[model samples]
Target: MARTALALREAESAAGRLRSELAAGDEAATRSAGSRLAEQADVARRHSDGWGFAALTHLPVVGDDVDAVRRVARSVDVLGADALPPALGVLETVRGGGLRSEDGGIRLDTLASVSGPVTEAHDASTRADRAVAGVRSDRLVGPLSGPVADLQQQVQELDRSLGAAEKAVELLPAMLGAGDRREYLLVVQNNAEIRSTGGLPGSLSVLRAEDGRVELGKQGNASLFGLSADPVARLTPDEVDLYGRNVALDLRDTNLIPDFPRAASLMARFAEQRGQQVDGVVSVDPVTLAEVLRATGPVEAGGVRLDADNAPRLLLNEPYQRLRSNEEQDAYFQEVSRGILDALLSGQGDQLELVRVLSQAAQQRRFLVWSDSDDEQRRIEDTPIAAALPRDEGISPSVGLYLNDSTRAKIQYYLRYDADIRSLGCTAAGRQQVVAEMELRSDVPDDVARLTEFVTGDGTYARKGDDAMNLRLYAPTEGRLQALTVDGEPAGIKVGQDGDRQVSVLPLTLRPGESVRVRALFETRPGQIGDPSLQWTPSMEWGPTRATARNLCG
Candidate 1:
């Protein structure tokens, strides 16, 4: 047992070194680390497969965890000995620009040839996921519990990433239009007037991908999808009740639902109605554009220079300052987005960096995507790019706090958020006690009332420069909201269920430099809980500082 434990520890450490060496492009160090990892993992695997360890694995409570460890040792052995070489070879090919053709289009042949390693890595991860699936961390014995749970969670995350990567490899050729043409709506979400997903669909352009090359098509603004007498598409009673009819009637409010897939569906339908047939929908906020600019150097948009430094401010805050009306703002947004889009499609900078920033953007929910093809969507549904609302399927329950601007102003550009969710304790049966506190601050000048009229919305709903937004807090699935308070006083919230999760909402306006603090007491459900989590609206400045506990029960 001691031998197996030490071997597994050494193997894990070696794997970390291997990863670091590979990232640093140190071939010799990576090969040495891989050899050490393989040896240690083999030792652990052989020892854990012995009769004594096999019998120990059948013991109660700890047995499953023991079996999980054995499976992990086997996977590490396989990964180190078999998977790493091909994966590294594939990585070398990609880094050498082996996938790009002379015309800047992706070479379908090269992509297909390199996918062998991805398939192997993906299959290994799938096996690991299955081996560690359904591990009940709550039932484990002391000290042993944390490590087992952490390893299990890591395996799950790795599986998700690999699965998404494999699927992308499979779908990339077709999606990139190897044989046929595909059109997609590239919507640039404006975070200045925040909506649930990221921002309002402030500007849009059609992109045509054919023969692996991409080209920009016609450009338009939100006004293209004129408001319909009725909703452009059907809506659930809950969606309308929570948000309002405008969520459906207006294209700009489609994202008010907070679910990217749902919002993209509506946007797609609206586009088809407005005379555009798209194979998919893609959305990115200005913050993501800023990240892209970091790789692309400076881009010229509307006779203005936009780089990583000024893109966010110019896209999110400047339009309201310089452009007077919605049409003018829309035009400015289009010009800027169009320029950035052109730059991205121009293939001017380090393509690898562009891919990295875009991937990070998707992970942060600043970029979202949806495909009309069911098979394509299925391949990505579990990935971050979908940016769907939190479902009950994940290992650890998630909490979401979404805000939608209702003040008819661009004041949300100056808003920032903070959240705290701490574990108080839990019942023996697995019910958890938690307190979630949230705060939203207005970072405007004291003379907010004297700000631009476009930003203030003329104080029709609240004081000038005050942002009146509908804020919603969601508890984990099957959890109950025990108490709610605003500032220091007890307050009532309009509570409803989004699926099994309880969602509470309220609307308020905050003056410049004013902040609103909300506290909610929750009795989380009788189920598995891992590390704490919190999700909020993606902002330009981010500014989402969250405090969470490592363990749900203490």
Candidate 2:
């Protein structure tokens, strides 16, 4: 048991490091970590499969405990021998020659070399999942049982991670334009001006990639697309009624659709009007850029030196303060973006850091992608980068509370938000009641009105120090809102539907140094509420904030 426990711990730690290394694009480190994990797993398998352990498992009292040890050991061994080896092989191949050449062109043949190993790794992960499916923690007893159960859980998590990596590797070649050149529209969203699908689209760029060489083409602010007087696409009655006919007016509001595919299509159509055709779309918020900066080190853009710590604040807020005219601000944004892209392509910074940063951004939903290619999109459909709302019936039901700026300004820079969720009770009809409360505060200074027009919107919408917001609380597809209130008073909430989510929108106005709390009572279909997860638009300066919840079912 001790041997198995120690081995599992070592393997888990190594696997984790391997994952980090892979995300960072550090092939050498990934291979080293994988090799270590493989060795540890091999030792664990031998120890657990020994004759003494086999005989002990057949004995009466501690049979279940020994069986648990055997199962975890087997999983670790499979991961090391079957899964990690193939993945390591793929990494080794990339290290040898698959990446971009000295001339900045990618070698298609080298990338294609990874297909075999990726397929093999995926297959092995599937087998590992099957091998551990029947291993149940409830079957074990005694002190060793808890440790064994934890190990089992860790193995399962590792399997899921490995599976995702395999899928990504399988799809990356197509995404990188292995067979043909691909053009994608890239949107830089400014979270200081929040929108439903992350942030308001502020700047746009065309990204072209063929064989491994990537280039950024024409770039401009969202306003250049020009707003349509009429709706650009067919709108659901709910969409028409909630967002009005203006939903299709411009690319900035395209994300009001919630579903990224719909939003991407709308943005693409607008781009086509400007003579830039794209096969896909990618969106990243300031937070995502900040993560990249962390990897690439400080870079000078538009005469401003931006490092990881200051990039978000400078990009999101400083522009408004430093630039007097919209054109200047737009030029500054374009320069910053171009500078960063050039640095990344130049291969000046650590490649491993870039990969790690991108992976983290995708995990946080700060980066999203949509493809017109059915095959390519299908591969990413279930990934977080797809930015799709929870629709799988098998997934635990969740309540989504998102904030969009109705102020039509960058006042979200001053807004702070907090949320709490509680599982109340279950009805006889198998409906679970949940309560969610959200609090929004504005820390804008009373003197903010004196700032540049860019920062305050110059009374284009609201006063400088006031923030008006459209707070949206969405219930699971099959769930219903029971009651809603603002600051302990009944409030009229606009209810609408976005794809599969039932949304309730509440308009809020917060003056400088003011705060408001909104509460919602909702019901979900059936099962006990698992641990609650929170999702929100990425903020410019805030790192990550978590909310505490109560599971009343306990």
Each model's lDDT comes to: 0.76, 0.72
lDDT of 1 by residue, 255-343 (tens): 88877898898888888888889999989888889889987789988879999998888887877877778788777878888888888
Show where candidate 2 strays beyond 4 Å. 1-18, 21-73, 92-97, 126-164, 416-450, 459-463, 483-492, 509-521, 527-534, 541-554
Please give the lDDT score for candidate 2: 0.72
Which numbered prediction scores highest in lDDT against the true structure? 1
Candidate 1 TM-score, C-alpha based: 0.84
Worst 10 residues of 1 by lDDT: 542-551
Per-residue lDDT for 80-193 in model 2, tens only?
A: 677777776766655454455786565556656776777777677667666665555545654445555555555555555556556666676677787789999989988888
